[model samples]
Every structure is written in structure tokens, then in C-alpha cells.
Target: MHELTNETQGARYSPTSIRATWDGTGSVKDASRALGFSRAKGYDLVRRGEFPCRVLRIGRSTRVVTASLLRVLESGEPEYSGGHTGHCTS
Candidate 1:
């Protein structure tokens, strides 16, 4: 995971530029960047079942499949209105 800093606030955040790879593997950090989401918000999306990306669990680790994430981004599906607390905000 990479830590990006907000220039003005000087607070460290994650990168927001999502670069798709040919191998179809994605990191949570990258996905968060692509979606303009905070790390906590990204995990919240997963818990709310709003993220369409497929996750692979290994032990206590989770991995997202890049292709699936890209598909969701391109599908024009409903926005993730299931707010961070698992309540639908739409």
C-alpha cells in the first residue's frame, strides 16, 4: 500500500490514479485511488456489498481482481448508495 500526501493538509493518503494491468490483478490501494475513495471508505464499500470486484481471501488478507473492478466501473451500474454503515443512502 502506498501513502500519498495531500499537499496543503500535509496529511498522508493513498494514491487515486488507477492504472489497469494486463495481468488482471488489482490492489485495494489502486482501486481506492481509481474510485476516489478513502481507504476506510473502500473497505466500507466491501462490507456494504457495493463493490462489484471479486475478492480472494487468503488467511486474513483480501485481494481484488482488476478485471472485475474495471467492469464495474464501466458497467454504469447503480452508484454505491449503501452508505458506510450498510444503510442505503440512495
Candidate 2:
């Protein structure tokens, strides 16, 4: 497999664009863009436990589950809205 570089993902830190290379999981930065958040805001949300999804700490890094993200997308539900009562963050 070809390794990913900034050029391949486009614009180096293009969060939205980086989703293409992600499979089962992705970083907070990538999920932030997918969820329409700025990087700082994403980290803040993670800290507050209000990121609209689970943020798992794996050793020295964090990641978001891509399957859960897809569930939200396929359901067409609004994320991070106060109306969220169907799901809980763990």
C-alpha cells in the first residue's frame, strides 16, 4: 500500500479531505472537520465530554470511531444539538 503524504490528502491538514484515507477509526482532527468543528474547538469538546461522539484514549493519542460517525450520518440526525437524547457518550 502507498503511504499517505500531505499531498495525497491535499492541503496538508485538510481535515475533511483526510477522511478518504481513514477506515475503522480517525484522529480528533479528522473527526472535527467531518463534524464541522475547528481543531481547537474539537479538542475543547473532547475535554468537556461534549464532542458528540466517543473519544477513546489510546496510549498517547485519541481517536474517534468511524462506524459511529457513519451511524449518525446514515440516520440523518443533527449532531451536538441539545435535542440529542438517542445516544450517549461514553
Candidate 3:
């Protein structure tokens, strides 16, 4: 997980860029960046239980399962499918 610096606020947040390979875990923003998902839309998908990748919550932190993400990206189907569209969101 890479920590991206916000120049406007000098704040740091995790957002996995495309250049960075999936490493089993990352923030929602990270997955968002990987899939070109807007921040709001990414969280919305999570809240709706329809995100393309698996979301893991630990306390206040949210993690996207890299393996699951990769599966979806490679196959357009979530590993734990249960009525999800399995469509890649651009």
C-alpha cells in the first residue's frame, strides 16, 4: 500500500496507482485508482455491497483484497460471486 500525499492539504492517503502491483491488500482509494473508480463511487459500491473487489474492514480502515481485484480484472468475475454484476467499472 502506497501513501499518496495530498498537495492541497499536506495530508497523506493510500491510493494504489496502476504502476504499483496489487499486493494482497490496499485502501478503497487504492482500488479506485486501480480501476479508475471515483472516490465517491467506490465507497458507494462498498456501501451497496456491489464493489468489484472484496472489501475488508479493520477498525476505521478499509482494505481491498488484491487477489480478488486481480481476479475480477483478469476474468471480470468476483471470486465470491453472489448476484453481483461482475462488470468492470471504469
lDDT of 1 by residue, 1-90 (tens): 133434522222212223322345666655665555676777777676666466545566756666566656667453432323554333
For residues 1-90, could you state the per-residue lDDT of candidate 3 as single tens digits? 133433422222223333264467867886766565687888888877778877777777878887777667667665532244764433
Please provide, for model 2 over 1-90, each residue's C-alpha lDDT reduced to its tens digit, 9 standing for 90 to 100: 245553464443344444456677878887776666688998898787677765577777978777656555456463442235754444
State the TM-score for model 1: 0.53
The top-ranked prediction according to TM-score is 3
User: Global lDDT of each model?
Assistant: 0.53, 0.63, 0.63
All models, RMSD in angstroms: 8.7, 6.8, 8.6
Give TM per candidate: 0.53, 0.59, 0.61
Q: Rank the candidates by TM-score, best first.
A: 3, 2, 1
Stretches of candidate 1 off by over 4 Å are 1-22, 78-90
Model 3 ranges off by over 4 Å: 1-22, 79-90
Clashes of 1: 1
- Model 2's alpha-carbon lDDT is 0.63
